[model samples]
Target chain A: MGASGKRPGGRSARVRDAVRQATLGELAEHGYAGLTVERVAERSGVHKTTVYRRWGSVEGLISDALELARDEPWPIPDTGTIQGDLRGIVQLVRSGFADPELGPVSSAFVAAAVQSPEAARALHEFFVARHDQSAEVVRRAIARGDLPDVVDVREVIRVAVAPVYYRLFVAHEPVTEQDADRAADAALAAARAGVL
Target chain B: MGASGKRPGGRSARVRDAVRQATLGELAEHGYAGLTVERVAERSGVHKTTVYRRWGSVEGLISDALELARDEPWPIPDTGTIQGDLRGIVQLVRSGFADPELGPVSSAFVAAAVQSPEAARALHEFFVARHDQSAEVVRRAIARGDLPDVVDVREVIRVAVAPVYYRLFVAHEPVTEQDADRAADAALAAARAGVL
Candidate 1:
């Protein structure tokens, strides 16, 4: 944008970013139920017809937002040890949902997915990307001779994070920092035991 | 009815039972979004006014259904060993979701709870009861010297069941029976490692 200076392609990308930001804002404030294309158009300053034509619907907006989120590089910890790395990953998950600004938006995604099959598929893909990225830590552990070469790296990531999700989403329970660390530790122990 | 001689209290109980059954049936077929007092009343053959008077809203109906479900006894397996017992419990959790009829109804509760705080509280209480009941097996394991007596029994139960729930509700991944067994085994491993 700085180099191109208002070219047609730059304008298109600006419009998409505007719409995605507005979508996250709306989801954060009003949740999936309160999101409307008209409101998003107003908030984003994109023309109503353009939003309608491009996004098609609220689900489309959510899916696009999720897709963009998935593409962003995550800060997977390179803490020099698998235990620290795993704990860092799980702690990041816990804190993400505890953030005042970010928590509602993340929860909004989960809330939306449960109600819509299309949204659920989008979320599934999002997790697929996330799991793949986060699995690198376990690979590092294997390379360092800390874990067996045959460990299911992705499964380790899942087990490490699953309890946090379960407590927050399924059981509606509060997740402390200790809870998150324990979850990571448990997954590591399981991996060490060859149970994962 | 015969034993109670159609007393007013007995009739009221019957009405409640019918409404509860209808609520479950509606939730199974159409999920939380499709549930309505009118539909529940019509399905139960109770007056619409009565349903509204008692249930108040869809969330209220959901809470009541969850309460009733909580009171129902779960088949807590006593397989004479913690390994088999933990496996049985996780398998039960996995299969309950995989069951054609029960799955949707159960999922509806989770769906509704995410959207409504009242339903979330009810779901929370429901899990409290379930955790208490399911923790008995862990206690038995401690008694039989199968586990350390000081272990956090409820945490073990939580960790065991969490991955299954995470696969289904959070990541939208398919949880195989082997996955269930592995989750249980992981929890056991964590417990033995004194991490839980």
Candidate 2:
């Protein structure tokens, strides 16, 4: 849907978008532990009663925000070769981690997942959806005889993205372009060895 | 040092041990965002003034707690082969993640690392020290010609550990023993391919 896409019964898409954006900003600033519905309503310029009546709780607000983010258009790259496609995926993830606005929000999501079962479920759903969307890359590679049919597509994708997340969230190390390249190469090497 | 080993001044060591234990307990219960010096002192049974005087801040308390954890003896597995050693390492990590008390405390540390600069630095130091200590596993494998000389030891180790951390922190998925085996196998495959 475009920016102006309408829902059935004429619910305001603009209000939903604004609320989600505000939720992201609040999460990035204060994290899930510090989030307040009043602040979200104020930041979104929506009435406090509306936020309370609709979202009901902070968990509801975060869940909806994650759903909205997951629903946003995320085009998977089609690079013909498995290596190229893996590289494209890694670079895309690297850029997302490097984004100033989105990076902290992403970190907040992880922090929330670590602390709350509800947030953890939401994060898991978001990732599972993204993985499903990206599975076509591996499927195409298998069809082209570049990857074995027995290869686990999700495992390959997870391996390709693991190092980047490891550095960003666990080791607190810098994630450079070279790191992304190495991650993709490592995953490809494992896939070729039939380990994935 | 052994359990009975004492410093030149015995009073400080006992106090430090008590404080660190209390910090871990507090982190396990409330996580980093909910942590407070007052609660730590109360639970530690140490005076608030003493805690304030020594730790000065919650970050300082957490840093010292992490240091103490790092200092604890963690023996590297030696299974006479790269694959065996890797499996041992993965199992060791998996067990740690599965521990009831230590597991939540570990997650709290990660959450702290994401939101605070001091905690991040402490976490980086902890991992770096652990990596340095564990480098001998890869070094022995290379010496035995199980892994190539050109292989990056850190990358191999990072690859082996990445999936476990990714599941625990990012995807919030169950990290089974089978998953750990797969991680070790994938890293070994990549290393054997000279991709690390």
Candidate 3:
């Protein structure tokens, strides 16, 4: 967080937005290793101390940036069936990968989280928030008897997402819409069979 | 490569092993950002040039390390069924996660591959090799009529592995033998349903 570039209505909020944008850019170009508070401050046109005061560490800065980005509208669509909801979630996650900026920033945080317990903790909370929010559509479908109530909804969420993340991190493959549809069908079929 | 604390067979090779080990230790503590070539040289008591000559880059070093680790005996057990081979593959991957040093290094390489194309290439080759190897076991099973000849063994490999990698990276959970068994079951069930 630094000096606001916008006309002052809420100066600090604007500065926060600037800082977040700068952080994402830095991460995309330089990765977690090269991302520094000083660089973020300079890029955001804010004082170095201001960035440090707000974020405390590069990890903290990244976590805040991710939190800010999370506010962007990526709602789970209220599709009538479990398969439909899963397709929507896959599309939403896939969009993150399409962005040259956000994709690497997300990966940077993911990389950082592996070695840092604090980062891991922050990431876990971030995932729980997103998963819980996105899982509502699936829960609704189960409640409406569109899906079997016997299947654990949480497992369904994980099953649907497991492949997307696998492609993202391990397979190094893009999560295509076709892939999402296949995953949705597979997950729903498993759930229907009381396997998921 | 650095100073060898072990029996001297080949000086450079010993130094390389030492440096590699030092790098692994550093990676466990520091992740990619904290790991430095100088530190590896110091830790191993070898010249930095030796490391650079051997690996060229940290990503290269890690790739070699993973490949070396993979060279250790890990076989897909034969129980005269596709399910047995699947279970073996899962267990083998699960065992890799059990290693304190190798596990973090493996995860770090996985996380880094998300950004670096070189790392991604190495990771991709690893997966392709694994899929081919595991699919051979399934192929034999199909020949024996344990599974339908129509099943795509490659997709079965993905299903078997997607869950293991998901647990390791995405879920940040340990992969138990039971979890492996479940994934095997999931793959077989999907294959039987003509989805995989």
Candidate 4:
């Protein structure tokens, strides 16, 4: 809604903001399994029937929150050097999940997406936006002659951040900041080698 | 049970195998969401009480299956070149997930691990064993001096496979075989650069 300065009119936007906020709060505190439409409605202070009529289910609530998340402004690093920039981007991802407040909500979206096809589609779109935004660093590197134009910019971003997400979600390992930096460096090395 | 030559025992092992197989079947057919002790019991032809006493819950069943899967023989690629072996390992992973029968079960383990702590522990241990096993290729590469001995073997495996998992689970994107090969090569490139 805030992609531009204008809100999508007042009341509807307010209702959506309230519900999305409640959904994030509930997700952060209780996770996807604990999220319920009634609880979200109560927490959001929107009428239960209104929540039901609008969101339909907890899945619907999560989907809407993810769509909203897609529009949220993400600061892409432009730290002059590709090395510093890529590391900054990967570190941002590592720390974002490490943030106690945002971690569970972000994780809940991933957890929900694995179980629900609707959530998966929403999460997919969210990532499409995310990858496009994050690939800016690679584009900048290419433009600056630090990288060749033949490089798969989005794939480089994916390869760079993939390990952090892997350690967090797939391998279930702890991700140190050094580990995040190493992942970025690895992707950088690969890009220079023309592999990614 | 098949890790070594001898089986763990007779009836008890057989019962465990039956229940575990039934658990995988259920997970494959219905996913983590539809997995249930009663359904596993019915499918395994074991008594519901017996299944309950043995498995406790769907989480327990999935945990047990993952534990069983950990010991199943994995053919470590012995291809002469580090590139061939690493690509083989990555391709094994990609093709395994693309297998219609095993894909759903493996995905269900990942899905369950994110939401259930008990399942997470089991999947974590499972990956521990898997990483240890897959790191053999890197170890061999180091031995052959294709890679420096200072490289992080397990992390290379992690990086090589991470993109596949990231595409599958996080980005919800299609992973082509070429994509899988490129991931393996990228990790190899980084390792050669002494960045991994």
Candidate 5:
């Protein structure tokens, strides 16, 4: 497993990973309110001062943990077609609904984002980065003339991914692969019609 | 000025409305966690016994307060065409974003909904009722041959409204009338093509 660069040796990397894992575990159990710097230090077998020095605050630790977990997922796929590319992105969105642990943690983060400016910025950055990755595929499709150059790729990306998040967080509907297919198809249709 | 049927034109009706108003004011001032039934009773001119007798718990009081303020705008207009109908719906969605007082109260309820099963159910029912109102407009369009009869109006309604809530609650995006128009257009196109 990949670990931080701040801690140099293999053993140091393992210690950092342990601390990050404990941070996320505490987050899942206690939410934004109950997660404490002291509790994380105790759980990770690291000194309290060391954890505080490395992370600065609970929000910083939470952000890094999310990044580490998120980076393990598959990269945006380039399938040489807009439909295939969108399908890939939808698959990633659907995966969140399938995982119980990730689902609740993500929900808590969303709630926290509403209240905390730092968390809000982090959440926005995370979505913008993910959308940028998927938008690259649409950019390629435009270059190949499969999609119109005038299409707003960001809007197209939003249309494709927003529904999946809506089903998971708002409606609590089953985010099936079929729902993914429908979302992709509608997004492609909207793009072709110059709505995107 | 609409009062509940439970206590009509009696001293009890005046006390109920006073308590409801005070509850909403407290929610605006302190949010859900900080709000208390005793505070509500003190803020209103009602006795603690009356407040306790009417609403058994804090959750019950919150639900009743929200219900008292519940006024979902009418659905898309009967313009004899989907274009005009969608324009009406989008306008309503836009107005919600402009409401400063309503915004925070609505968000607090959404956050509270995560913990209370009854609140979640009430939220679902509120949305379902809104969806049914919007769906009726789409259904009429199908009857008028502006849209296909095979279209699923329920799904189309979801596509139109979900983005508004997603932007409001999750993304914190300003949901302008233009955004609503685009969403309505996209959903209408999908429905016309029998995609939904």
Candidate 6:
């Protein structure tokens, strides 16, 4: 199975996959600042001209790689209660950040996003998609009258994840499962008070 | 005046100030990835050997620059009420991020923190100090019975600032005063509910 759990594709598709994987490897090892098309081409065993012609620049390659990284469908939980749903989502995010392969790649993307406009746009699109995908939980809570209609659904999700990111990127602290639990619970508390 | 608002040192302090200011200017224009010791030396009118001997490496220079950036004492709000104190702090942070001079310099530091371990350590120390400086607000709230005794004071402060940082770095959104108000209110609601 390929990245999407589907059968492998033709030669061109295979080449694209190889290049994307190589791009991620470069990002993990050297970060976005150190990534180069020539290095990616060498690592992927693709011609430099082909890599340059296809991706155009390092930003273009990074954008494509980010899309590929988030290609898998996100699992949105329906645990009957907003607290449970939030806990589930936060746990998933925490685990993703803790993954050795995904952690560095995600960090590199975030670092790149802060420095480059192209990366910023890509990161924004990725998060917006993820937020939209998980909007169902908030909708369900509203239907169940657990939260007021005035509450901002996206704000709740943002609140639930903000502390995790804060600890990871800003404080450079360890984010444990307890921290994830606290994040979910804190958001839930604020939402219940109708502040979110 | 020196960094602490008291002029004590002579030529050495002046040179340090000039070099640190030049480092920040370089970081603001070229970002951490693009910053070079040679450029900093030329910009500061210091010899390359002096720059090298003083800081040793790019990371060392950035670390020193970060220290100088945070050398002054932070203004801790004492607005009597926890809500008032939080609002003051968050508003101060929002304006700092929006300031033309400090804005890009701070973004550069955050970007450098994500990419370099030394920068990350400097960034973490800066925040830890800020958090400690503001701890009195939460302590006052607890004393007044505004929040539960078991509430984690540091967690509340972290929650208050997490949203601002989230919008600034992760979501790549414009952080407004209204957003700052909401962040303070949300953290207050959570603290009131004893989740923080």
Q: Please give, for residues A113-146, the per-residue lDDT of candidate 6 as tens digits.
A: 9878998888888888888777779889999998
What TM-score would every model get versus the actual structure? 0.96, 0.93, 0.82, 0.95, 0.83, 0.91
lDDT tens readout by residue for model 3, A3-67:
54455757877788899889888989998778889999999998999988878988788778767
lDDT for A126 in candidate 4 is 96
lDDT of 4 at A97: 99
TM-score of chain B of 3: 0.79
Worst 10-residue lDDT window, candidate 2 chain A: A2-11
Q: Backbone clashes in each candidate structure, one number apiece?
A: 0, 0, 3, 0, 0, 0
Which candidate, 2 or 4, has the higher DockQ?
A: 4
Quick one: RMSD of model 6? 4.1
What are the root-mean-square deviations of the candidates from the true structure over C-alphas? 2.0, 3.6, 4.8, 3.9, 4.4, 4.1
In model 2, the runs with Cα more than 4 Å from the true position are A1-8, A28-34, B1-8
Between candidates 3 and 4, name the one with more favorable lDDT. 4
The DockQ-derived docking category for candidate 4 is high
In the predicted model 1, the residue pairs found to clash are none
Residue A8's lDDT in candidate 5 = 62
Error of 3 at A127 (Å): 1.3
Give a tens-digit lDDT track for model 1, residues B64-125: 99999999999999999898999999999999999999999999999998899999999999
Query: Candidate 6: lDDT of A179?
Result: 90
Clashes of 4: 0
Query: A59-167, model 1: which lDDT tens digit per residue?
Result: 8898899999999999999999999999999999999999988999999899889988878888999999999999999999999999999999999999999999988
List the candidates ranked by DockQ, beginning with the highest: 1, 4, 6, 2, 3, 5
Displacement of residue A80 (Cα, Å) in model 4 is 1.1
Q: Candidates' lDDT values, in order?
A: 0.94, 0.86, 0.74, 0.94, 0.73, 0.86
